[model samples]
Target: MDASDGHADREWRLIREEAWPGPMNMALDEIAAETAAAGGPRTLRVYRWEPRTLSLGYHQDPDTVDWDHCEREGVGVTRRPTGGGGIYHDSHGDVSYTIVAPADELPGDLVESYHELCAPILDAFERMGVPARFAETERPARHQPACYLRELHPAHDVVVETDGEERKVSGNAQHRRTDAVVQHGSLTYAVNAERHLAVFADASVTPAAFRERVTGIADHADVSRSEAVGALEAALADWADATEGSWTGDELERARDRASEKYASDEWTRRRPGRR
Candidate 1:
C-alpha cells in the first residue's frame, strides 16, 4: 500500500496482497471488516493474481459460466459476497480495489454510497488525461452478465470519450454488512474481448461485438500503472482522512482461517437459494 499524500494518522490501513486465489481475497476483506469493527483501522487493499481468476457475484450461478473451460485453462474461480455479475481477471487488464470502512463513514443511501466511493476512480481518469464521467441514466438490463457490462444505480462506471463516442473504463459493486461496507471493483486497462465473449455467450452483447464499449487508460491516456495508482491515492484522499497502518498477526491468522472455512467451502459456493 503506497501512501501518496502523507496523511498518516487518520486510521487507515493499506494492504497489498500478492495474488492469492479468489476465496482468499474475499476472506481477507471479510476479516478486515470484522477486525476494523473491533478497533482495527479502516483499510484499502490493492492486489493482483499470479494465476488469473473469475469471481462470480453472490447471487450469480456457477453454472452460468463454462466451468469446464475455466478448469481446462486452470483459471481460479470463487464467488463474491457482493451482488452484480461475474468478472474474469487476467493479469494485464484488471486492477482490483477493496475499500473497507465503518458503515457510519459511508453515505446513507446505497446509490450515494456508490458515488462517494467511486469519486477517486473518476479523479484518476481525469488525472490521466481522460475526460470521464458517470452515466446519469439508468443502467441497461442487457449489460447484466458481468459487472462491467451493467451500469447500475450508483456505480462510478467510468465513461470516457473516443471520437465523441462514450464508453466504460471501469466498474464496481458494493456489499454492506451491519457494521461496515465493502466496495470492490476492477478497472479495465486492456481486455481479452474474446475470452469475455466466450464466457458470457448468452448475454446480449458478446465481448467481440461490444469491444468498442470498453475503454482503458492504456488505450486512451498515456499513463503507467504507477501513475494510475497515484491518481487513485489522491482521489481516495479527497474523501478519506487517511493514516498509515498495518494489521496485527492475529488479524491475518483469523482471515486465513475464515478464508478456508467460509469462502473456500463448496457448500457455500454451490449452495442454491431457498433450497436448504
Candidate 2:
C-alpha cells in the first residue's frame, strides 16, 4: 500500500447508493462481510432507510425501547451487527455507509483499522464544507439509550464545532469476525430532534438537549441531502480506488431471506445475545 496514492494491491468495489428497509439493510451488511471473506471484492456501500428506523446496538437493553412509540410513529426497528447505542435513522436526515473486507486486508489493531476506514468519511465531511474531525477527548455519557448522547471517543466519534462546542455529527462501529470485518456508521445530514427523541423510552432527554449534543452537516453547511450523499460516495470510491458495482440477484435473494429469518424477527431484535 502506497501512502501517496489511493491504489492498493487488492481490488475494491463501490456499490452505488441504494435504499432498503431496516431489516434488509442489516441483512445486506452481513451478506457483504460473508462474501468478502469468501474472496469477493472489498466492498463499500452507501444506502438509506426506506422508512424511519430505530437500530439498537447489539448489546443494548431492549428495555430502553418504547415499543408503542415506535409503532405509533411508524418507525421500523432492528438490531445492528455492530455494537454501540441505539440510533433513530431518519429516512432523509441520515446518511449511512458500510465497508467490508477480509480481516487480513485491514490493520489488525482495532483503533488503527477505524482510522483507516474512517479517513474517507472525514474527507467526505470536508467536501461538504462541514469541518468534521474525530473527537479530541472523551466526553462523559449524558444518556445511555442513544448513540449520539453516549460518551465520545477519539477513535471513531466524529464531531463538529458549533457555538464554540464540539458536538457529535457521526458515530461509527465495527463487527469483526475471524475471516472478515464490517464497519458501518451514520452521518447526521440533518437533525429531526423531536422524532429522534420520540423513539426512546427516556422522557428526560429533551429535544433541546438532543440538539445541543448533536450537530448535523446541514446545520453549518448549505448542502442538500443529495449533495451530501454524493460527496460521501465520491470520497469512499476514491479512498478504496474502487470501481462501480451492484448487488447480484443471488445476493439480494439471500439478503431478503436473512431479513425475514433474522433481522425482522422479534426473537433476534428483542433478545440480548447469550442471555435469556
Best by TM-score: 2
**RMSD of candidate 2 to true structure, Å:** 1.6
TM-score of every candidate = 0.86, 0.96
Native-referenced Cα lDDT, model 1: 0.71
lDDT of 1 at 80: 85
Off by over 4 Å in 1: 1-9, 151-155, 163-165, 201-205, 237-241, 273-276
Give stretches of model 2 more than 4 Å off. 1-7, 273-276
lDDT of 2 by residue, 1-276 (tens): 253553355678898779899999999999988899999888899999978899999988888899999999889999998888999997688999999999987899999999999989999999999989999988888888899999999999999978888899999999999999999999999999888888889878888988988999999799999999999999998887788998889899999999999999999899875653
TM-score of 2: 0.96
Candidate 1 residue-wise lDDT, 24-123, digit = tens: 7888888888876776688877667546777877887666677677778887777788877778887767777788888876788987888767776777
In model 2, what is the error at residue 116, expressed in angstroms? 0.3
Name the TM-score of candidate 1.
0.86
Backbone clash pairs for candidate 2 read none
RMSD of each: 3.6, 1.6
